[model samples]
Each structure stands twice: as structure tokens, then as C-alpha cells.
Target: MEKIVLATSQIENIAEILEPENKNIWAWIGKAKKMGLSDYALGILPKLRIHEENEMEGLWLSAEEPEYIAEILEMENNSISLGKVKILELCSHAVETLPKLKFHGEYVMERLGLEALFSEHTAEIPKIENNSIWIGKMKRLELHFYAIEILPKFRIHRENVMEELVLNADSPEHITKILEAKDKSIWIGRVRKVSPIEHAKRIKGKLDFTLITPDDQEENGGD
Candidate 1:
């Protein structure tokens, strides 16, 4: 176990000693500092030490590294101080391993919720294609339309409207005229396979559109 004395002033200096030649160790040190780890402790940390290994090997640390660090620090301090040290370590690991886990988890949960709703209702929802839209049946005579439309208003193609609208299988009159007018049967087939109401609810948020066109014109008038 490589050890360094952690005093308030020596924290930054200690971190400098552990800095890698290629990568900016300062950024990681800053992050550790933000998590309330002393600079000296961060310098000698197992994870940072692994960074000194071959570049191809990559730096890896276990989930318990922070807890271990906390334990060591507690022993060194001769007293227990309560704060976010443990939480920060766990969070850092989570942040390091998979940043998109939160988003992916939410998406999976939303899909499962929709599946449950469909099972309870015993109805198949109309699928929306083209514009990333869907129409589903929540109850008898009640239909829902959900979509993720990308727009500067120009991106809204005919496929968007055709796929997002759902129609009742038994009642042809309830079907939208636009979908009925389409030439391809396969496109219509895809729109008919929509997911249930619970899934549709995930789309309750607003559609965000990014402007690709530059706001300022150049001196030569080039785009």
C-alpha cells in the first residue's frame, strides 16, 4: 500500500506526484477532491495507481475502493466524520462505469409498463412509423397518439403522420383518411402494430428540436 501524509496544504502537491505523463490526472484529482477525498489519499488510491500501468491495460477499480479509502482515512484520523465520502465513492464508480444507465433503465421500465397495460386490455395498439409516432387504444373508443417529431418544420415528412395515427380494426369509419390513402400496404401494416397506453405515456414530454442552421452569417456569406 503506497501511503502519503494528507495535510490540507499538501493535498494538491500530493495529487501532482501521482499525475500520469499522458493523461490529465488533475481532472480526476479535481473530481476526487469534489467528492471530498484528500489530495494525498487520491494520489495513492488504487484506481489512480492502476492508471500508471500500460495504457492498453486501462485503469480499473472495485466498487469497495472508496469504502476502503474511507476506512483507512477513519483509522488515520482516529475519529469518524460523517459526510458524503462513501456516497461520492459509489457515485464516482457509477459515473465511471456507465453514464447512460439511468436513461436506459427508464426506457426499459416504460416498455414494461406498456406491456402490462396491453396484457390487461388484450388489445394491440396501432404503430406509428416515419416520424417516430404511435397511436394506441387506452379504452373503448378512446385512442392516443404519441410522437417524437424532429422539426424546423421541414423534417415532418408524410411518413410521420401515417405511422403515428391509430385506427379501430372493427370500425373503418374511425380510421384517418390520410392513412387509408397511402399506396404501400407494408407501411400501413407497420402502423397497425402500435404499443399500449402505458408505453405511450413515456412520450408525454415535449419534442426538442435543435437548430442546425447557423445564427450568424460569415463575411463571405458562406453557410
Candidate 2:
């Protein structure tokens, strides 16, 4: 029921007590925003209390809480890539307020800002036109469970510059089709328990694959 008003000095003091190694969470959040790590920042945003008086204010539930959140709306509005923020929050009230960005595709293009290697919706992959510049520039691609179903929709031509692929799936069977679909060699950077590491390595036609196995988790002290 108590509100911790946020100021530069106050944030630093609290962050020192909460995260000794990191001086302030706001610093990290700002860097995350600049680095386009919206998902990571959003994961911590729900616990925040948006101070009615000051939207930029940071108010956590308590000092004892393991996680903290802050109101980042003002920061987001002032971001260098404001359009990118809108694309990430497509269904939110923030995006709905922008009349110029009414159409999804054009504003998505605006959000891309000529540097995006790839983009996707919640469950749908963006349709890549033949003239699109991302053809040979996309070096890394990650396909989640639902995205796997539409794998056949896009073509990974031999000319593609893709060097890394990450398959996110709970069951090995779901991604088995993905491996079989690709005839060319792709460096699989990581697989999220989609298959036995050895089996994935074997069928994938390459020996190199990275997965955080239980042993690796134990060694790293587990997250």
C-alpha cells in the first residue's frame, strides 16, 4: 500500500540494495529499450504500479519482492524507434491511438525502419516478397511451435545468408518436420528440449547443436 517515488538518486540507492552488482534497474531497462529487448522488459512490467500522478514514476510492490517493475510508457513514447514499440504492442491501446499507423503492413514497414532482418506476428509469419531485401541478409531465424506449422509457407532458398536457426518446441515430433524440410545445412544454435541433442544432431546432418540440458542447468546453478 506504500508507494516508493522514483527519482535518479532514489532509484540508484534502491537498486544498490536490491541488485548490488547492477547500480540501477532503470539503467538496465533503458538499455533494454535501446537494444530492442521489449519482451524481456515486458515480462517485468506487470508487477509495476503506474503512479497516477507521474507516469514515469517507478513503484514496486515492496522492497522484499524478488522482481520489480516500472512504468515505461513515457520512456517508450520518447524512444528512438517509436514505431517499433507500436508494432510490438499491436493490440494495446497505445497502438490503437495512432491513426497514421492504422494499417498493419505499412506501419510494420515503418517500424522495420529499413534495418529489420525479419519480423512476425503472434502466430503468423510475414510474407516475404521476391523483391524484399531481407532475402540474403537474415542471418538468424527462430521458429516457435505455432510458427512451425507455416514453415512450408516460406522458402529458405540456397542463396539465403541464414547462419543460425533456433527451434522452440516442447515435443521432438513437432520440429522433426522442420529438420526434414530443410535440405541444406543450417547451423542450429539452440533447441529448446525439442529433441534429444544427439538425435537432433544426427538427423540434422550436422554434429553441432546447443541445448541447456539438465546437467548444464545444474552446473550453472539453474535459472
Winning model by TM-score: 2
lDDT tens per residue, model 2, 1-223: 1122332223444444344454355434433322221222332332222222222212111111112122332233212222222212122111211121212122212121111112222112223222121111234444444333333433333333233444445455544544654343333333334232333333344223344454544111101
Give the C-alpha miss distance for residue 223 in model 1, angstroms: 45
Model 1 worst lDDT window (10 residues): 105-114
State how far residue 55 of model 1 sits from its true place (Å): 37
As a whole number from 0 to 100, the lDDT of residue 131 in candidate 1 is 31
The reply for model 2, stretches above 4 Å from the true place, is: 1-136, 149-152, 155-160, 179-223
RMSD of each: 21.0, 16.1
Residue 51 C-alpha lDDT in model 1: 22
Candidate number of the best lDDT = 2
| Per-residue lDDT of model 1, residues 83-120, tens digit only | 11211111122112111111111111101011111111
lDDT of 2: 0.29
Off by over 4 Å in 1: 1-106, 109-167, 185-223
Q: What is the TM-score of each candidate against the true structure?
A: 0.15, 0.25
Error of 1 at 80 (Å): 44
